[model samples]
Target: MQKIIFYVVVLLCLVVTKIQAQETFEQRAKVIAENIENITREEKKILKDKVDVINTQLENKSITREEADKMKIEAATFHAKRIEERVAFEESRLNTLIKEKVDGKIQEASADSVTSKRVSIIEVRYRKGNGNGKRKEVIEKRTTSQLVLAGGVNNLVTGGAVANSKFRYWGSHFYEFGLTFNTRIMKNNNLLHAKYGMSLVYNNLRAVDNQYFVKNNDQTELVTSSTWLSESRLRNIQLIFPAHLEFDFTPKKVNEKGETRFRTHRSGRIGIGGYIGANLQTRQFLEYQRDGFEVEEKQKSNFNTNGFVYGLSAYVGYRSTSLYLKYDLNPLFKNNSADQNNISLGLRFDLN
Candidate 1:
């Protein structure tokens, strides 16, 4: 009777042990399945984000549509491969757990701990994931930069009139190159902006007669050259800091998510502003015949010109090209009997 009772208890113990081992294997299998699903979802989300960036580049015209499509395909292929590899790893882990259970090596405690502490693939990959499991879209900055180039006719305005100017109208010219930054003024509005930058300005003037500028005492005057003159030009270079209040007419765009974005230099723009700087250098270039030989002379001097320069400027046009006008508020030369201010009209290009 005692032997039979002992055998019955032993049988019941074996049944309970088998049931616990089966439960552990099932729980581990469920955890592995969950891990595989999370890996697929996370990789798909990453691929979608990459495609969105490529599409934005296409829409901005930064890249061709064909290039964007190729980038998307590459991103998709890479993530797909990643998904396959990661899922295979999880499946291998599940297979290992099953083999352990068949060999009676899996611990019931280990399986219970896994169910309570399921591995998060996203946390393992991103580490710094934004807890919410969603990515925030990037937005355009409030301030942007651009390159500016302007060149056109330059002349001096005497008594506020271009017709009364003494310099040759068509021969005089100016060229300017600079870097500028544009900032949106209002938080939500895109119509108004503040533009500021630094520039190097070159202004040239040619005398109507065969003449050149000469410094006499505290004054500078244009005098007829003694030799047969072929060319006479006065060039002044300045370092200028300009600032303007710009009104942009480019219509604001709303994205699919209904977020407002300001796209500048896309349509008509008007800028009214001023610049203040100092004259860097002044030189006179003369090309003429001296005796029987051609002579080229470059004379570098202050030429009694104003050291401090300030001017008012404005531009109006569509897109990047604009009709730009600038007028000096100060006299071109100091202590001169006739007051002459420098003026320029040109085409300005503000390239992004």
Candidate 2:
């Protein structure tokens, strides 16, 4: 009987204690539920406010309605998540406080204490990895071009014995002209250059001089002196080969001011070149002669001279056109009792 009474008393104490624990648990749960309900209400209210404001914004066509709605949803979700995190932190704090009551060693979390761990994320956009949109167009920095035009006239163009001392003659003043074709070969920020052309010349010649001759046949023991015999005229043509390397102020071509391609100028280049030509083709001039026994004035004819034409020309003149002055470095008459220099004033043209 005594043991049964002791067991019953113990059972009664256990039931009462369990009932008190159950009531405390119910009270705590009720408070947690109220807190959760309050948080949910605030979240719904925030969502409602965001939706209303976003709808107003979407009325403007600047942003699409779908885009505006997405922003509203994101804002609401972020706020709700914040509230949920706060609730979970509070619950954990309460549990820690309850545990701290049992042990003095455990530090209790304060209401003001918050989780100090911070998390952030950075994202990279891979718009290019999806696919390239378009191809870029390119522009050329260099251009192609050309220039052409006619130049001035020329006078005093010739090279032969007339300008020579032996068969000295000067009557006709020849004419010359030039043709040029030039294109830019190179160009930079500072300079421009061409592979060919500075000037080109086309030359013509005409002159007149009286002739006097004395021939002696030693074997025949005969001495004859010629009279003043005159010839009709003399004419010639020369192809002037020209080449020059020059520094120009303008990166363009220049025209001549005076004289033909053979006129000697005050300043210019002086280089050497060879030539071939036909001189004294039917050249007639004045002369005096002694025919055997009598000395008399007569018409001495047959003033035609021929052979391969070989000579050289010199240069002078610094501007654009060379003052056409050239000396026949090589003479035509081998042993015609005439060692002479033929000179003229003209222009200089660079062929290449």
Candidate 3:
């Protein structure tokens, strides 16, 4: 009889405790639902008004059936999105409430002298193996993007050159434009990343001392012209793929809602990378005097230029503006006596 009475008392206590925990959870759920209702009150009404307007327009023959159907889809999409947002908000609020309740119970138990002997309501409600562990929806962060533009002086560095065959290093020009996409490699961490994209690169090299290139069967060389040559330059256009391993030196920030956000300013940024390109076309421009008249000629050809080019590149910058440098590793002219490589140094702008 004594054992039976003890078991009955213990069972009653367990039932009462479960009831209390359930009541607490129900109260928190009610509060979260109320808050969600308040947030969506005006928005829901607006959605209803949109639906009514669409219906009235269709009934009055102000809109065609197809147009009304499209409008209806738009309205439904907006309402569905709003409802999803509300549900997410409610879920976050409920998690917060549960966490706070657990923390408060822990504090109260610690303050009591019988804490070692007592079990907390929160611990029982949210114990291990319980089905109440909710997975929070992850928020997708926005990625930084930009259009990159660079311009500078183009020069040819030769291993060896014939007499009067050097490149006009200062007068040459180079320019490139690219659309760059940047993605964060890790959540809330922006210390390292990969930057890659496609670019249109143009390189122009003007010869020195009124000289121009002539391509023979297996070689190309610079030769002097007797005519009064005003301008002569070689142009190369290439479609290039640029890839960089970049690093950010800025500190991370936490927003008011306790979410981590990276400050995506380009300050204190640096990158080292390489690019490979395919030659689109090459052309030679010549302007000279013939019979007391100005004559301009543009000759387009392969000119024995290499079909593929690749090189090393680097950049250092502050706030989307950087000093850029590139050096080609391979010779420009294939099967040529002169071994010349291209180098460019200039200012780069990253417009985001």
- How many times do residue backbones clash in model 1? 0
**Model 3 C-alpha lDDT versus the unseen true structure:** 0.65
Residue range with the least summed lDDT across 10 consecutive positions in model 3 = 118-127
TM-score head-to-head 1 vs 2, winner: 1
Order by TM-score, highest first: 1, 3, 2
In candidate 1, which residue ranges exceed 4 Å CA deviation? 1-135
lDDT against the true structure, per candidate, is 0.73, 0.34, 0.65
Q: Least accurate stretch of 10 residues (summed lDDT) in model 2? A: 117-126
Over 113-134, each residue of candidate 2 has an lDDT whose tens digit, in order, gives: 2112101111111123324765
lDDT of 3 at 194: 73
- Per-residue alpha-carbon lDDT of model 1 for 1-352, expressed as tens digits? 1222222223222211111223554344445544654676677679879998998899999999889988987887787667657755864575455446546785543534533433211101112446699765444467766556677789988876789566888789887756678888987777899999877678999997688999998899989877767889999878788999999998887767666666676678999999998887788999988677899998988899999999999999976668999999999999999899999997776644
Return the clash pairs for model 1, or none: none
Model 2 regions lying over 4 Å from their true place: 1-172, 177-233, 244-310, 314-321, 334-338, 347-352
Worst 10 residues of 1 by lDDT: 118-127
lDDT of 3 by residue, 1-352 (tens): 1222222223222221111122343333334444544545555578779989999999999999999999977776776566546645655565455445435542321213322322222101111333567544443444555556677788887764322436676678787755565666666577776778767667888988888978887787788999867899998877678888878676676766665556554348888999997777788999998888899998878889888989999998865557899888788889987678888887675544
> On a 0 to 1 TM-score scale, where does candidate 1 land against the true structure?
0.62
